[model samples]
Target chain A: GESVGLHLPTLSVQEGDNSIINCAYSNSASDYFIWYKQESGKGPQFIIDIRSNMDKRQGQRVTVLLNKTVKHLSLQIAATQPGDSAVYFCAENWSGGSNYKLTFGKGTLLTVNP
Target chain B: DVKVTQSSRYLVKRTGEKVFLECVQDMDHENMFWYRQDPGLGLRLIYFSYDVKMKEKGDIPEGYSVSREKKERFSLILESASTNQTSMYLCASSSSTDTQYFGPGTRLTVL
Candidate 1:
């Protein structure tokens, strides 16, 4: 999501439950969108990716939905575990041909409570 | 498997000191980028290079510089460390496809 004013949006989910995090992008020319997970001390790891030609893509226990009409994207994790707790960010790229720069979201902190 | 390694996990420097952060990628990637991640502010691109000896200033380039003398190595240099520059610095590399692989970030604190 875009920066509202000064703070980033966050979500907390209970362990063993499902969780959904949403993001809105501003680029209309972006052809690829991706989601990344980052722990407290590590860099962002790739979770999933989707192309503008596709509306939905699913990975192992994680699903990503893209709505190009509204430039919105969502990530769904089934049976969220405590290890799933981290900061999630959505990035968009226009990598159809030439060098494309990736634009990242403000990030959403997901806390999975046990 | 792709591997990206950062020279340091944590770094602290005094004000007006010159700082250098190193990054190495095992995969032969042509494009490398340097970014800073803050608590509230997401990741902001500082600099990027597509080829050795070629560099471009990203969205925010003030007070930051970058060097890419080799294909697998990219270095970020802070001319004079400042308190405002205290943040998590990340280095990333990608094939021509643009799916980036990031290294373990280096958290730089300037006093």
Candidate 2:
């Protein structure tokens, strides 16, 4: 079965440092990808998304990079802050063959130190 | 802003009890989804409705059912709640773009 997964379960970074979260997807037919941020006791919030046609997309302090060749995706956050500590998940969406579902990765817990 | 609201922020139910989780979206979107988030399972879709009265079973929809009688509201029903059903329920709505807007979520505990 095809699935999406994260490279790491947890990541710790300093307040001023940059943080990167990695994801690997097995489905080659997936076209759209999204990044979500979930805080404690809250639902996942949409951060940024990228289509398969493009390799990278940027929003605010966040950037999403996609590599179709390696079936890999990454989310980069610049100038990490304490408020940015949360769990991040990568989701892949396939539009082919009556498939409009989004497959989500297990997620990576990000901790920003003061 | 697209606002999706769930009926409860937290719920407690006993085993074998019937559970209902409600979600409403103010954006009048045509797509609504119900998902459960667990510790290491990420988010698993229980069900989704693309339009009024049209429902589709998701990846994990064995013990769950959905009803979408109206355009703005979608409901998830658990026939017989069990201890394994304890999880965080999330509701989301989207349009043709497929960018979902999620609600605050409801934490359910079945004891």
Best candidate (score: DockQ): 1
What lDDT score is found at residue B76 in candidate 1? 98
**Cα misplacement distance, residue A10 of candidate 1 (Å):** 1.4
Q: Residue A1, candidate 2: how far off, in angstroms?
A: 1.3
Worst 10 residues of 1 chain A by lDDT: A1-10
Candidate 2 local lDDT, A16-107, one digit each (tens): 89999999999999999999999999988999999999999999999999999999999999999999999999999887834367889999
lDDT per residue for candidate 2 within B7-111, as digits (tens), equals 999999999999999999999899999999988778999999999999999889999999999999999999999999999999999986778889999999999
Tens digits of per-residue lDDT for model 1, A1-114: 322111247889999899999988776777898899999989999999999999999999999998889778899999999999999888888766346568888788999999
Winning candidate number (TM-score): 2
Show model 2 residue runs off by greater than 4 Å.
Answer: none
- Candidate 1 residues B1-111, lDDT tens each? 889999999999999999999999989999999999998688999999998999999989999999999999999999999999999999999988858888899999999
